[model samples]
Target: MIEKIGNAIKDKNKSAVLLLLACFIFVFILPAIEFTSNMLSIFLFSLIIFLASYPISRKVMFIGFVVILIELATRATDFIYVQYLAQLTTNLFIIFLVGSVIRHMMNQKNISIYTLVKALNGYLLLGIMFMSLVAFCDLYMPGSFNSSGNSDMELVYYTLITLTTAGYGDITPQLPLAQSLAMLIAVTGQFYVAVVVAILVGKYASKN
Candidate 1:
């Protein structure tokens, strides 16, 4: 069973589908279950390791798994430093995975549904990466956002909103760092869209 699962994740298209499912659960479903709320960071980190297994090196995968185990073991202690490390690690892992996805998309000779799915996965991963950053800022620096008692879901919503450049203004960033992150998220989102579109169009044009 384990080997089967590993093989499924080894395929780019299959792994993209799995990542999308995990992202949907993290964003939409997990928040509804009250007990799972605090596990958000760990869940995201686990996904990082799982998705990284195929594209990244074995050494990186082992390191990520070790970090996840450490985070789980120390969950009861709630050490501020440990939490910071976990969040930072999660952000870095997602960033690397996103880069891998982009490189894979660019290297594809033909555009197809799999290519489109990979592009979508990359976009969602960007939002997830920024969400981790937002959470890190809020965790270490209280009052980073104007809203009080911000839930994980609320943070996810705020990140997506900022990523999409919707600017609803419901949950505005308070601190300078948070404000800067918001701008970075919006710009990164637009840049990803432009790059993906260009790659797809170029592939299509070349095929003609």
Candidate 2:
């Protein structure tokens, strides 16, 4: 059973599907439920890491597992130091995952549904990764963002809007670090879209 599961995860398209589904739930569904402990959020994050990391390497998968363990400890203890560790590990893992997805897409010779899904997954992961950074900034410096509360879901929402360059003005970044992060997120979002479209078009043209 373990081998079968590993083999299934090794399939890039299958893995991308699972990762995208997990991201969709974390981004869309979990916020509505709004659990106080954010237990569900972390669980989905761990699942995404597990799915996303397998396509890269077993080493990355193991590291992501360790990060998930740290996140679980953060939720259980709610210690500031553990939270810091969780934030760091989660941020690094997501960054690595995003890079791996982009690298994989770049190496693909044909543009298919898997390529499109990987692109989408990478985009969503970019948003979530920035969300982690935003949360880290808030944790390190309280009142970083002008939100009613510092919930993970609120950060996710703010990050998504900032990433899309929406500038809703409802949740503004107050601190220097937070404001810089918002700008970086917005720029990175635009850059990712531009690069991915170029890659896809190039691949399609080559195929034709």
Candidate 3:
């Protein structure tokens, strides 16, 4: 079954379309299964992105990336409050993806120190923008992610502020899960900037 499905996706036949639709339904229709199914959706999404990038080149990956995000948001939306938030974040993500993808694609040059630094900066910017979207959805849009028994808004607020290193007092995460995620995002954000900047600076020095 897995092989067959993989082949279908590879072929881009009717089954692939059906599977994509099924993925959409599973991702959005079963909010009860959001965590479980989203795991699957996310896995497939990663492949879709890699395929999208490899086949069309990274230059075209942004469109697929943005489409996937919007599709997920559309499917997940149900409650009015959550739907509103989903709509907002989805739009922002699409815009960010377009700008990020275009800049990277347009600037592509033979891989070297200069290209490497720019690519890292590009990826880091993309990652943070994506994280921001997730934070927004997690906070404002209920059911976009499972709360596991906590205030969703608090999660959103904490995610955004923490990722930005804002450390706002109003939305400190008390739960172990939230705290862990907060720590992870903080590390990710800082490391991304540090590593990318260092690489670019190194490249600059070598060029001079």
As for lDDT, the candidate ahead, 1 or 3, is: 1
- TM match of model 1 to true structure: 0.83
TM-scores for every candidate against the unseen true structure: 0.83, 0.87, 0.39
TM-score, ranked from best to worst: 2, 1, 3
Best by TM-score: 2
Candidate with top lDDT is 2
Estimate the lDDT of model 1.
0.75
Would you list the clashing residue pairs of candidate 1?
A: none
Q: Rate the local accuracy (lDDT) of all candidates.
A: 0.75, 0.82, 0.50
lDDT of 2 by residue, 1-208 (tens): 8888677677878878878899999887887677776567768888888887877888988988987777766877857787777778778878877888788778888787677778888888888788778877887899999887845678888999988888889999998888888889999999888888678766876776
Query: The CA-based lDDT of model 3 is what?
Result: 0.50
Error of 1 at 181 (Å): 0.5
In the range 80-145, model 1's lDDT, one tens digit per residue, is 787667757756766776777678677878777767777777787788778778887888899999
For 20-130, candidate 3 gives per-residue lDDT tens digits of 354344333433333543476466544535332432345556655665566566766567665565557555644555355435433443335435534443443344344
